[model samples]
Target: MLAATEKALEAEMNRLKLAVKTLQGEDKSEEIYIGSYLLARLEELGVTSMFGVPGDFNLGFLDLVEDHPTIDWVGNCNELNASYAADGYARVKQGSVGVLLTTFGVGELSAMNGMAGAFSEMVPMVHIAGVPSLRQQATKPMLHHTLGDGRFDAYIKAAEQFTYSQAILTNTVSAGAEIDRVLSDCVIKGRPVYITLPTDLAYAKISSDRLKIPLPRHPSPNNADVESFVIDEIVKQIAEADGDVVVIADACAIRHDAIDELKDLLYKTGYPVYCAPMGKSAIDETYERYGGIYVGSISRPEIKEKVESAKLILSIGSLKSDFNSGNFTYSIPTTRTIELHSHWTNIKYAEFPNIGMKQLLPKLTARLEGGKAKALQLEVPRFDAHVPQETDDIISQAWFWPRMSKFFEPKDVVIAETGTSSFGILDVPLPKDSVFLSQILWGSIGWTVGSTLGAALAAKDCNLNRTILFVGDGSLQLTVQELSTMLRKGLKPIIFVLNNSGYTIERFLHGKERKYNDIVNWKWTGLLEVLGDLDGTLSKSYTVNNKSELTELLENPKFAAAEVLQLVEVMMPKHDAPRALQVQAELSGKTNQYAL
Candidate 1:
């Protein structure tokens, strides 16, 4: 007892000594300002890359960033683009937070869309904005970029709606804690957080001991009682079911670390698991018990028939959204439906039954006697015959995905940019254990590029190899500033830019007659070369207009050594991709049916 007490006392003394050292040596107030301190905190948080477009208000901060070897400042053409890239980097790197710096008002507002998207998708990001100095705050006179009267509170309130949390740093003491709290929340909740730093505060000198970097607290699920009950109910239903049972895995199910557990459940039961479009590739495609897309127009007929015939529908982490349930076509009738989700279980609303997945999964596993069920046979439909000859002229998302699949190794992590490219990459067969991270719920473009950096960082920590990125031309241009980050860090990733010009997905939805579909054709190859810090060893660009050129570039030895390689100008027409074609066919069929 005496020895244990002495050891504990020694550990406490060591911690106190380290704390004192951190206060004395690390927090010394130099002539260097608050911006430097802010940069220091970012560096301490392991944020090596910052993406943004420098403006008059934030230029000082940018200069400070330039001098900091630990932090690399990247420039984008627009603030929104920078945010998107940062979002992508965060998703890829997992624990690494995204830092998006922009000037006040318009710059801050422009990036809000991306931040909101990150919030919805639960991507951890930090949005830092340079606001007008404290002296400029109370002036009733008109100010540039000011929304109603000159008060900044309205804009801050607007930001609050989109992020997990928001704060304005009027003074130094408030700045550190607020920044720490917001960043800590972002890490804990896995969502975007906002901080607005006043221009004047950037140059102010802060006291030494006041610099406190709080460790983040990760809270696990506290309420397990309800979850256990739901799991028991699900297991009872499954055991009683006579017909082949089907488990429809959704995005929420993918969370809560249930994949392996659910896979084990499937292996024992021999029940096929079908994922929704949003939940595509939830399980290994090679898994014999795996069934493909089920609800949308893209679903296989065999999978559809099985779903329709199932006596028991075991839905794990399923949201009964319009996109998932064929617009309510597959509503449960007399069938026993066990709906599992987060928080609550056995939820009944207006006569609909639903249960909590967290409760249901564990209990269900416990109740079941471990044994393999007989394999059930099912037929799958072929949609190739419906595809038209003209579709061949356009690059099929189907063809593109299979080829792209080859680039991903078992350990590689991929971030898919939003729009048609996102849909295209969703079906691609990834190697076992390969992670596909995306802001699917937010559908924010330009997020993948920045998220890729974060993913790459995460991959490095996991001892994983190269991080692969698939981005649309429209999205890539938005966050192209992050190229400097890749070069600065010496992180290599294969970037495939699907360059068909402006918002192709939106264009397809609006129809070809829309003049807004056009965008300024950026020379992506030239841009990467210029933006990259050329030590003559870091970056290279390749332009591939056709399959032959793409093949040649992939085969070249020079491509292997390049730290940042950009495959520019690969045209994929909107009409060719499966999702696009499906939509087109539906619209065309409606028109034809009405004409007849």
Candidate 2:
């Protein structure tokens, strides 16, 4: 009996010894740190670069990112720009997530607006914040970055409103699971997520076992009954249609990673493919069945007549924001419409739940493999930028856009700002493999400055063509500091600053002549030198006031082929606006008049 009791006592002592060893951090040699694990998961998801501004709290986490071989840390000028950069990164690379690293309270709060915009537009981004240690939180010490009220949850509570999932890793034991869960939420939902990792927890040891398993990013849900019913209803609508069946693809088609399936569906059915303004460049525009862009009231006459008169409209991944739908001018009837979304499908008035685009698209494409092609009545207008133009005229809004058409090449990632830049580019057809990113739904000015940095990085990763940015002066002023970051990174993009003087979109909205729509003028071309430390090696900026100068710059072979950062400020009339913008603004004004 004594021998057995002694054996049990020895076992208890050994267990206690191990417990003490773990407490003293002696047994962590075989374990992986949470920082390394988080990066590994991100690398597994193909994150080649992370964008953020470094701060005292997040320096430790940044160290791990720096040490990682697969991912590079892109330092931004500020947290807001970093968040916008992440949004742009996600938009360029389909099915890949963007990560933004920042510090606690001040850092996270400053990035809220940019992340909120991502949430509104369904871009998946991870906003990882380095916060005060759990020990500091428990002691309730007043922190420099905190609000000093001792309640540490205020920033997180604010984030909860914008983020799809918010996780605080106070306990290292649950860090791996928590990180996986939050990132999964971001990817699966296509929205930004907030993850607060305490400064102490960055180096915390977690089991390496979880790293062996892949985190589920895309969760496919299949309700056989619902899908069957949904597919049957969709096929029947097309069959009973009197006119040609047309498709209206939108931004979510790219967000939901359904481009390939969409291509297959269009190919098999021989349906004419048209993109909503948000979904511009979602498909290969060079394809034979490619139709023009459809923005309802703002659509070109031929395109509008074809779409409105369609017998059945297959709207895929459609997010019908007012701007996307041409100020709510869509006239397609519910009885003749079928909508396919990432989460659900609506056939006319009936919506079937639990049917996701990623899963249903493939099945639907297979069903339509031998389906009949629609006989389109009208042909989309052919686009050509080489049209005749006067030699010595001042560049106007009418002349600038078509002139830009010849400037674009295949594989270019075009980013347009919220004002004149965004609306003007709507009329220009993108080249093959090109992308169009704009904050039409969110309408945040100055977003393109930071997004240009991200889109350039992503474009380099994919070996795509140039990164082009179009922003008005007022919008550029809001986030122009990011130019320094772009110069520092040695990325080359053609940045066109519409020198229309001020907030052209806002002027179009309400204040055409109000002081609120005007802004202080700066030497726009001199900015590149100022931001680039006056070094010609970093970038070249120019200001063009007339048509000849702009055309001359476009025709310069050296400028066209140069790998240096190029900035061109195109001067135009202050009162000029795109036709679409003018019409939409007028309609919106009348709509608001009823409220007044």
Q: Estimate the TM-score of every prediction.
A: 0.73, 0.93
Among the numbered candidates, top lDDT falls to 2
* Top TM-score model: 2
Error of 1 at 587 (Å): 6.9
Q: What is the per-residue lDDT of model 2 for residues 1-596, given as tens digits with 9 covering 90 to 100?
A: 22222333453454454344345543344688888989988998889989888889889989999999999999888999999999999899876888999898889888999999999999999999898888988897988988788989888999999999987888766677778778778887899999988889899888766655556655544577877778877777776874368889998988877787788788777777788989988877767677768998888887888888888899999989998998889988898888998888898898888687767776777776565433444354453334346575788777788788888889999999987878888877778989889988998898889988998899898888999999999999999999988888888889999988888888878878999999999998888888875758878888888988999999998778757899999999999998788888888887776454
Candidate 1 per-residue lDDT over residues 296-338, each given as its tens digit: 4445556677776776777776655543445444645535676
lDDT (0 to 1) per candidate: 0.64, 0.83
